[model samples]
Target: MTDIHPTAIVETGAAIGENVRVGPYSTVGPNVRLADNVVLESHVVVAGHTEVGAGTHIFPFASIGHKPQDLKYAGEETRLLIGKNNQIREHVTMNPGTSGGGGLTRVGDNGLFMMGSHVGHDCKVGNFAILANNATLAGHVELADHVILGGLSAVRQWTRIGTGAIVGGMTGVEFDVIPFGSVIGDRARLAGLNLIGLKRKEFPREQIHALRAAYRDLFDTEDGTLRARAEAVAETAADQPLVKMVTDFILEKDDRRFCTPRSGE
Candidate 1:
């Protein structure tokens, strides 16, 4: 029960699963694989070695599985893996990986990539994430589950955004963001916890309070280095998983700095 418009081009080697639809002027490349119930709207181009999971819907003008924009890429075989139930909106451009970046870019289930959002080469995007209009991830960025990038935001290469974190509109995020963190500013800085998201998720009030306290101790106090403060908080909030999420993220080995509250804020 697959429907492909007469004007659409499905290459000979393309794999189309059950109940799939390819709209007018769209092109499915030879190496592309569309799973069951996938829909590609008019004028979409799915190329390279890309795989779209079942139940995903791609809107018009989306350029999926394009070659990596990296100059280092020398026409090597790479792949873009998009998970199930994702909504990829118009003008979204997602590129595959490069040989330098392990040759794979992965997106997890239930993501919403709004218009003009770009997923760069080798990026790892987790489940339930949303990238607002014009939001962009540079190469090798990693977004943990439930992360949200507001409109016009851009993340620097190699930065990792922890689970449940949200980056506000128009921000340029150069540093890692801790789990459940809210960050905003032209140049990003940690604002606070994502209280609204936590409440929506029904996180326990006690756990939220403990996480808040631990966040204060970790960031507000200027008595020690971030790592030392995170270690202390880890010891004190050892039993609180929510608090531990932040501490563990801070303690994890990485060369990049993380977003922190503004001085004297």
Candidate 2:
């Protein structure tokens, strides 16, 4: 029971699942697969080796599953995998991965990608993430579940944003962000804990209090290096999963530095 507009063009090899809808002027490439309950609004172009999971809705002019933007890309058969229940708004662009980046760009379920937002090639976005209008991720970035990027924000390539972190508007994030952390600035200085997000998630008040304490210990104290402090916090707060999440993120091996509080603030 699929509905395809007369003006739509679905290539012969494209797989359109049951109950899907294709709007006018949209194009589905031969290698594209639209799962059950998918909806493609007018003027959409889903190309390359892309798979749209069930219950996903794509708005007009979304150039999804396009070839990687990298200069090194040479017509390789890379893939873009979009998970279920995503709302991809107008003018959003998502590219497939290049051979150099494992040949895959994957997005998890329930993401809200606002207008003009871009998910660059080779990026991995987790579930429940929200990319506000014009937010962008460079290639090779990793965004964990429940992360929020404010309008006009951008994440640098190779950086990782841990779960529940929030980046404020117009920020340019060049380093890893710890779990539940809040960062704001033109250059992304760590602001504080994501207290609003934590509370919205309904985390226990005691756990939230412990996490705040650990945050102060990890950043406010000047007694040791950040790694040393994170290690100490991890040991003492072993019973706090949220605290451990941040400490583990800090301890993980990565080439980039992390966002830190600015001087005198």
Candidate 3:
């Protein structure tokens, strides 16, 4: 018993589950699958080989499952898979994967994509993440669980945002963001531990304290050798969750160096 607006155009080959609502002037293309309780607001377009999970709501003028805007993209069979209970706000554009990038763009459950946000080709967004208004993630980016991108922030291609990290507004991030840390500004320097976010997530006090200590040790250094700092923190603070997060961040760094502390601190 789906409720489809008369102005909406749903192709016969599209698979729509029960209790779905298609608003006026929306379009659903062939090979698109809308699961139970999904709602597409007016002027929304669900195209290509896209699959919308149950209980997901897409707001007005949002575009999902469009082909990659990459120049390297050929006419390959890419797919976009969105999980359940996601709220995609107005004017958001989520693009599918490119043939060069394995052809899959995936988003996990309970995520919030705010108005005017853009997710580029082959991006993998984890559960419970929040992309604030005008937040943009480039191709091949990965957002771990509970990451928060503030308004007007843009992440460069292939960058990874670690779990529980908070990216400040108007920042341009070109490197990986450490887990449980806060980043701000164009060069995206590490501000401090995301204490407020940790508290909201119900992280233990001991863990938070240990993370604060680790942050001090890492950033308070003269030369800021993250490897040396991480090793030192691991030896003493290994039992703490925050210490483990810092250790993992140091180990996972590929080519770029971690954000260093400001001088005279």
Over the stretch 1-265, how does candidate 2's per-residue lDDT look in tens digits? 9999999999999999999999999999999999999999999999999999999999999999988889999998899999999999999999999899999999999999999999999999999999999999999899999999999999999899999999999999999999999999999999999999999999999999999999999888678889989889999999998999999999987455999999778
Instruction: Output the lDDT of residue 24, model 1.
Output: 100
lDDT of 3 by residue, 1-265 (tens): 8999999999989999999999999999998999999999999999999999999999999999988889998789999999999999999999999887779999999999999999999999999989999999999999999999999999999888888999999988887778887999787878877889999989888878778878888777765467877777788887887788778777765465665545764
- The TM-scores, one per candidate, come to 0.99, 0.99, 0.95
Q: Would you list the rank order by TM-score, best first?
A: 1, 2, 3
Query: Each candidate: RMSD to true structure?
Result: 0.7, 0.8, 1.5
- Runs of candidate 2 exceeding 4 Å displacement: none
Question: Would you list the rank order by lDDT, best first?
Answer: 1, 2, 3
Quote the lDDT for 15 in model 1. Answer: 93
Model 3 ranges off by over 4 Å: none
C-alpha lDDT of all candidate models, in order: 0.96, 0.96, 0.89
User: Considering summed lDDT, which 10 consecutive residues are worst modelled in model 3?
Assistant: 253-262
Off by over 4 Å in 1: none
- Residue 181's lDDT within candidate 2 is 91
